[model samples]
Target: MADVIKSLNLLETLKESIENNKLSDVKDAVEDLLISRINLAVVGDRGDEKATFINCLLGLGPGDDGSAPSPSPAAPEEVACYLNPKHPDFRLWDLPPVPSTSPFQPEGYMEKVKFPRYNAVFVTFTQTPHPHSVEVFLEARSLQQQTVYFILFTSAKDTEKNLEEKRKASLVALTSHGVSLPKVYLVRPSTLEKLDFPGLLEEMARDLPEIRAHALLLALPTLTPTLITQKKESFKALVWAAASLSGGVSAIPVPFVASMVDSSVGVRILTKAQSSLCLDNESVERLARQRGADPARLKELRTCVLSVEVTKGEVKKRLAAAEKEIATVSSKLVEMAMPRHARSVSRSFAAMLQALNGAIDEMAADAEKIMAAALGKGK
Candidate 1:
């Protein structure tokens, strides 16, 4: 309960900082909430398909083949770690299958890989269920670990009936071994957008709400409207933190210095939000190129509103102007009446909060517009 109160106080401080335009305080607040790492493990027999699916989630293209290792049947069970370049906190582990010819038991295999360390484990298979994979899943359940049984179809063109039949057979296989059927997801590596990809992500988020902001926001593709909305909502929570920090900084007796600090913090928050939403230059350029659209158009659209640098510049300009006005009023009040000076300072804090709120609203709206344009919805 004490920890919860501390967290709430920190969030309140962050929100106040953002509202008061105290940039440095907002940065401190945001840094406090940034997740260090979220561990996800992919356990499967089909190494090639598993690697391909992992790469797809990382948004790597064919040219980036070596980004994830595709282990073959003949190869040893080596664990490969894949981190999202944009959000390094999300770590995906590709765990090799337990060899059929190996003398070691399933429990030994689990211990070798440090299975309990993972927040979520995915047991992937193609066509039929493998006994070794089922053994690993049961062991994971016995350890009280969160696990998902994933079916990756070899053919993207498989009909719904065929997919359902495969799912039933997989369940039967698990039941035959006296193991309960785990949450299952059917996916086609070639057509990830069509299947239970989003559902799988939502399930992970539901199970691990503490790291949901980093887990789902970083791993899930931004091709769908639902994903974009989730990204926005995740960032919105940070906005309050930023605002609280800004407001706290405004209480300082120093005049111009507080405003300067606020400008810098605001820039960092906006930049972080841009990256989190996958609206950075690299992501946008990749999207434009993929859709056969001119990358220059994205730049043009960004200049109008979505660009973080542009937003930062505007925020600094406005804050600077406000600071000058506040300084003049403060000087007059200090000479004539100290009470008036204190009141003026309070008003300035309120004004800064209002301005910051407008800036945040504009940036969020621009982010949405940028996403729509990337999806080919906006001309």
Candidate 2:
């Protein structure tokens, strides 16, 4: 009971340190003594030390379950060791009181079994699980409090059915017994350091800082600072490119912008060299050769531009009208520069590139800006 109290006190101290952002003392306290003594307990039919059977594996423990099913064994359950490596850095202790043997009928074999302060318990079973064993594990989980209960079934048979039944029964027992307990983790034992077993270990690491120490040791690489930096660089490039193409869609006739957007920076730098070529006859022919746009889709693509193609007008008149529309959209593009959200981010580069080819209306806004002084004086 005092151990739990001490653990709570340490936790409160840790919480205070975090809130105050003062952790220098924490680092200095236990820098050298960094070993975690993980405690483990084995129980039920499969956990019997005599019978060396089962698949999933964990931390430092021996190969067999101890009294592994002998070639010619006698009512083997009583003669079994509850835990194989009863004493080790990570102790797998015996669970006392094997049901059939009473301490009064000589000595309850289980009564002598020491219930070690364990980190977790490995509840073993076979292929077609006996419901009795599942019941014992469920009861053990309720009593263990913070300790994690992991189920290990080695028989290469349909074991899922028994596990589901245990789960439903455990849920009911918790309500009836009023025992707030941790969930039983179902594990397929393999190698000790197997990546898949971390979740089980983490569950049992509550009061034991040592268990958590090893976990954090493996976890650091996955949460490196370099990964965070890489993601930021990617997002930055995307935002920058979106800014440029959106600019082109709103600009004057300039194919150079397309090349500008094509430049590759660390991420993807958008192009600034704008190219706008119309597919209406002469300009259309020029663009078709340059951009490889399908001849059929040229007109459809042209409709996205600001000016309509004129077939009958004089060359100068058509150019004059096209230039006027170009300047108007150019001004709008500048206005879009200060927009609340990025404009071109959602659009494809080709779409923005198409917008650049609007025919030049010869009505010169540049000339008007220049001749405004003369007109002002006359008015």
Could you say which candidate leads in lDDT? Answer: 1
| Cα lDDT of model 2 by residue, 1-379, tens digit | 1123333344344334323434333322222112223445566553332133221121112333342332424343432233212212333343432354322321233234433354455554333223433444445444543443534433334256866665555545444544354354444442222222445544444434532333222111111122222222222222323324334433344343343343221111111110111112333333233334443444343332222233223333423453444434454543343233434432333222223221221111211221232223323
Candidate 2 lDDT at 319 equals: 36
Local accuracy of candidate 1 as per-residue lDDT tens digits, 1-379: 1123333444455445445556565554356344335677887764567777776666554445334755543345677788877657667788877666655478888888888777777777786667777777777777777644555555666788988888788777778876764555787764465577767766665556443434445344465556655555555455444444344444545332454346665665566656655567776676665556677676566542435454766767766666556544444433332223233344445445445545555655655666567666333
TM-score of each: 0.72, 0.33
Worst lDDT 10-window in candidate 2 = 266-275
> Which residue runs does candidate 1 get wrong by more than 4 Å?
1-29, 32-36, 46-48, 69-75, 102-104, 147-154, 212-215, 218-220, 249-261, 289-294, 297-312, 318-379
RMSD of each: 7.7, 26.4
Query: How many Å off is the CA of 156 in candidate 1?
Result: 2.3
